[model samples]
Target chain A: MTDTSLIDTSPQGSTRRSWTFTIGAIVVGLHLVIGLSTLFWTPYDPTAMSGGRLEMPSLAHVAGTDRLGRDLFTLIMIGSRIALIVGTGAIVIGGLIGIAIGLLAAFASRTLDDMLAAGLDILIAFPTLLLAMLIVASSDGASLWTAIVAIGIANSAIVARLTRILAKRVLRMDYITASRISGTSWIGVVAIHILPNIWPTLLVNLALQFGLAVIAEASLSYLGLGTPPPNASWGRLLQEAQGTVYTAPLGAIAPGIALVSLVIGVNLLADGLRDIADPTRRRRR
Target chain B: MSPLLGIESLTIQAGGKPLVSNVSFSVAPGERLGLIGESGSGKSLTALASIGLLPDGLQASGSVLLDGRQVVGARDRDLVPLRGTVAAVVFQEPLTALDPLMTIGRQVGIAVRRRAKRDGHPTDSITVMGEVLDLLDQVSLPQPQRIAEAWPHEVSGGQRQRAAIAMALACKPKLLIADEPTTALDVTTQAEILKLLGQLVRERNMALLFISHDLPVVAGAVDRVVVLRHGSIVEQGPVATVFGQPSHEYTQSLVAAARAFDDALEIAP
Candidate 1:
């Protein structure tokens, strides 16, 4: 009876199984290829007015031309590159600063831990974009580096809060005590035991944060608090395309699709990665 | 010979409420002492205090001298050198005691490496691996090679406890504290672990501080027993005399319970 039921469910079960990771990877990978290829060549100089204004999709001007008379395809390729750069840079900055602060909070004394926790809570309560804008406004003027640093600093509070909670849970386990009793130093315990145990979860969160950073960067650019002209950030493309939307609808829709797809791809990737990293969850399915 | 562990007027408190109050006891070198109590009686807290490993927000007052070193109120840094050298602990739950991510061999190897480095011995990978396997073998774990390669979850409870014992013994500590080490195992596995622990302690000539709620298990493992009730010592004496003729009402009740359990087992067809 069990065998027959298992056989009947096999085909349906295979269909029901998740394909998010594969789809996410493919979408992200396509964007990456387009982004990287821009380093070597683009059909035309993205910043130059090489095409007629508001040209419809054609072999010469695929994705058409924007109001500025530049190839929309070239603008999007450059936009993908900037998006990836900001995502990678923000996540790197956030991961280092956040993990360090979180570990410190986990190991801190009662009073100190409470102070740090409260401080992190306040930082987290602020909107990421607003916080990024404040940072960007305060530190010189808006540029690619400024936006990256601002978004990173703004995102760190959430990451730190997550790391602290996870590290504290790991700290309470008996193996930690056993490790200590075995003469492992505090630093050694953090590196060997705490970090390895918590990293799988952290990796998933960081992937999600990557998507958020991409969106945050675009938002900053849209508000003119991001990279200046000629950089062609997706947010700027969407903003620039808005005036010409009725004449060349593709101009506005192109960047919008790019932004949505990247974020959705990363979110799906994170969801799939979680299942892969956690064996118990995989076994349950 | 000097006592390996001496606790005088030791009181452990959490949030200002005393959990183990004014608990006093001493264990001489090469002696086997049992701390028997019911759950929440503070037996585990006493063991933790001895090693200066009491959990956060819990403070231990008074003196706990282990190998002539003060454990009460000692800073963690000050206690590091003494840990796994002067004394080591085997906690109750073996599955939780060993790191889930690490292999049994690697965990044991870490302890061995630390001990070797402290003693100024060569800490090459080969020497450490050899020592890890030796310790696993000493614990009588079947196929030390296979057991060494297995993760904690892959092994049975009894094997895990044996591996835990091996990790503790890796330090060659002067004092070994087994805090309800076999409580999580079945009756058969418990007896086997108790036997393995007894053999290891005898072989090393290390002082043993066995903590358990099981009266029969404690009686079989130690020379003297300290009975704790509500975080205080109700009675303490040689196991034979204490079990044969108890003085405190609490001690008498504990003795009666053990006897009743044994009687039930004997009458069962």
Candidate 2:
């Protein structure tokens, strides 16, 4: 133990810096709670629609009614569930796959690194949405889970590429070399030394992926490649609103604003994290 | 009695270039041998190659006997069980040698527990951690308990170097290959570290292979100094003899350079 390692007990120690991380964690926690709650609860049969069209905001139907006569606010909340689930699902699925492939590729050598980087170069060159749509379209539409799986698989490629690059860079650092020479097994070196050091980078990437997943899920839903019809999603609402855009116009605008606002919140949150969690940026602060 | 480490006809190739070629050395028990050479003269490479840590794309070949058993050309995986047990190396840059993420106590405790195994019997791990705190105190680290919780980034350069030394000592290694351990320290700290290392070597009865470019530091440390030039030993004898009357032309030039360096540093203040 060295005296220098003692944490400062001043009221403004590491706690202040950890505040944003705490908030971000809560936001993500709420996302999971709200997302999981949908498996059990909802205001109404969201797709029931009361068999009527073009209704206004009322106690019976708060947040008014869409052109398809669905509850607006309830649908938005439910859409929140769908967005969070698909976003988390895709990012996690792709994130794990990416991390495994990346670590292995990076540990292999420059030849393997170049091969992976070249493959990712081609993947990154293509638009992510377009790839998701292509895969989702080719799959059977009756199965909503199938769409998520397709999109999730498509998204994993990018994450794997990113993790590979991060692993490669981390492997070159002195701590990693030292760990290796200390006779730590390669797996131990990767798990303890290499992974912990790159965690901030991984967290930032996770945030970025969460935002992208939300938009991608929305786009897929909007194209009728997302959560099945009568299954209340903002993307589905937007799709149904296309016919009455000239009429209520509110239906079109509501889901549109909802999509943009949610995406904006996630992006702002991710952007704030990107600035805060970054060691270089934190050092500047 | 077998020497702690035996390097016979060792060669190292880095990026298609021979860094150290056909080098041989040995460290008898309780004996300190200095491998003295200027930068790029391959002394450090030879030390690293003995421990199988020359980095990627660099290759080491020939017989390396630790405790008189062959380890040269051994796979990296096979080397894990031997580190700090048979041989431990203290690198040139201690600040980088210790992980920035781990505490000094934790780092030393790892090696201490790993090597405390006795006759293949089970051992209590926490007992070794307490011993690690003692070693931290041994290295003159103030506030041993709290210091054990802190990261490497929090320590000063000299303190970090001492902690690195503490880690090397944790496993009670038979052979210690220190590659210029005091190069990064202040003169006062350098002198203190040299004296402390010298004392520990005699107390533990361990073999020491000390590598350095500075003649004065080496002069104060090892019992016998082996001078190298262009990947070959140019002089080998007692440190006093080499410093007082060098036989090889290269060794004489090095002695002259060392004298001039001391004179220059003396007048600078």
Per-residue accuracy of model 2 over A207-249 as CA lDDT, tens digit each? 6777778777777788878888667677878887788888767
DockQ for each candidate? 0.34, 0.41
Show where candidate 2 strays beyond 4 Å.
A1-19, A141-143, A242-285, B117-125
TM-score of 1: 0.91
User: Model-by-model lDDT, in order?
Assistant: 0.89, 0.74
DockQ value of candidate 2: 0.41
True-structure lDDT of candidate 2? 0.74
Q: Candidate 2 chain B: minimum summed lDDT over ten consecutive residues — where?
A: B114-123
How do the residues A114-151 of candidate 1 rate in per-residue lDDT, one tens digit apiece?
99999999999999999999999998898999999999
> How is the predicted docking of candidate 2 categorized under the CAPRI scheme?
acceptable
TM-score of chain A of each: 0.91, 0.82
Which stretch of 10 consecutive residues in model 2 chain A shows the poorest summed lDDT? A1-10
lDDT per residue for candidate 1 within B74-167, as digits (tens), equals 9999999989898898989887888776778998999999999999999999999999999999999877887777667666788888999999
